[model samples]
Target: MSNSQITAVTELDRSHYKTKVYSGGHFIYADEPTDVGGTDEGMPPAALLLASLGSCTAITIRMYADRKNYNLDSIKIDLAICKEEEMNKDTTITRKIEFTGDLTEDERQRLFVIADKCPIHKMLSNPIKIVTS
Candidate 1:
């Protein structure tokens, strides 16, 4: 087992329903929307989770294409995520990748295979342990 550890810190501001998160010198704010009594200061936790998955998928595909010297102009990834309680608290995330460039069908199809191979995708598909104090 790997002993490597990654950590982040978040503090809640007393004034509003917002959180300040610090990780590796980057600061992120997370909050609930105004409809839920928050000031809509930043992205909700759900959106943040979805963004991580989508961005990771795009970068993975881009890196693979670049390694092969594929002429890829643009890449677009769209993901929709939802939680279902009926399935014993199961969550589903659907991803759609759009590539804009001169590419063959095989290249495009190969990207689909590569998308699922992203680290984040693998993490989500597998079991994870979350320990909180």
Candidate 2:
């Protein structure tokens, strides 16, 4: 098993809903929108989630293509989260992937399969346990 840690800190005096997030040696800010009593200084939580998944999917596809020597030029991923209370169902995430370069249909299909193999995708697709102290 592999473990990684990230820390998020929020100071009310600094902003109502802005948080400082530290992961590895990287730092970023997360905040809600201004209408939600935030200063809109950074991406909201849902946007961050989509960003992670999209990036992971792209990287996973790129790595596989490169390893196989496929003519993959670039990858673009679009992701969105949707929740419907009217249907009384769980939240759904939609991901659209676009690949550029000369590739056969078989290779493209296989790449689609590889996208789901990304760590973030697998983690989100399975049941997760969050233990807090």
Candidate 3:
């Protein structure tokens, strides 16, 4: 993999937890729900994490299928993260994939394997350390 670094910046004001995120010349909003004292303007932090994984998985599968000349129409991914009550326990993330295409059972199984090959999935499956300065 190329040694590339991605930098993202976020700004949060007194607007009840609504945050502005900027990366790669793009911008998006992250906010908490109204019940949590946010304006509910956009996806929360947890949802954003799942969105990243889902998009990466779908893109990886699509690229693989196209490269191998598989009859792939579309890909749908559903992801949910379950937080553990005990802090020491690991959190569970459930991902369900649906494909609309003409593929054999073997191909389907291979796609399942390919899903795990996504960069985000690999990153999440491994150990991560966040350093704050």
Candidate 4:
């Protein structure tokens, strides 16, 4: 498998009433004064998820623009996730992607469609089999 496809494991340490999480070959601690016991120094998992989507969207747009030879100065994507009362009965994730740059109408629409084709977006939208022992 490719390096990006490799599985990773995290080990947590909780001795003397202190919590620490080790993952990606590094150690992370909960944020101080928050008491959530997450990476105090690093971003929480949920934040990381949102960030991943945003970053992927931006990078995907950039790649598409570069491939098309579009004179794109920059690409910014604002992502937000919210739960809808009726649709989120079982807890669903809803994301909003906003693109900002100098592009024609067609390019703008095409890029939006391309954003949905991102690797991470595909993985999240599709179902996967998880095995645990």
Ranking by lDDT: 3, 2, 1, 4
Show where candidate 4 strays beyond 4 Å: 1-4, 15-39, 82-94
What overall lDDT goes with each candidate model?
0.85, 0.86, 0.91, 0.65
Instruction: Candidate 1: list runs displaced more than 4 Å.
Output: 1-4, 83-88
What TM value does model 1 have? 0.88
TM-scores, all models, native as reference: 0.88, 0.86, 0.93, 0.69
Candidate 2 stretches with Cα past 4 Å from truth are: 1-14, 83-89
Q: lDDT score, residue 7, model 4?
A: 45
1 or 4, greater by lDDT: 1
Model 2, 17-133: lDDT tens per residue? 988877656788888889879989989888998999999899899889999999999999999886334322366789999999999999999999999999999988988899979
* Cα error of candidate 3 at position 50, Å: 0.3
The sequence of per-residue lDDT tens digits that candidate 3 reaches over residues 19-96 is 999998999999999987999998999899999999999999998999999898999999998642432437878999
> Residue 98's C-alpha lDDT in candidate 1?
98
Q: What C-alpha RMSD separates each model from the true structure? A: 2.9, 2.8, 1.8, 4.3
Report the C-alpha lDDT of model 4 over 47-112, residue by residue, as the tens digit. Answer: 566777878777887888899987677776665555224544354455665555577989878888
Q: lDDT of candidate 2?
A: 0.86
Q: Which pairs in model 1 have colliding backbones?
A: none
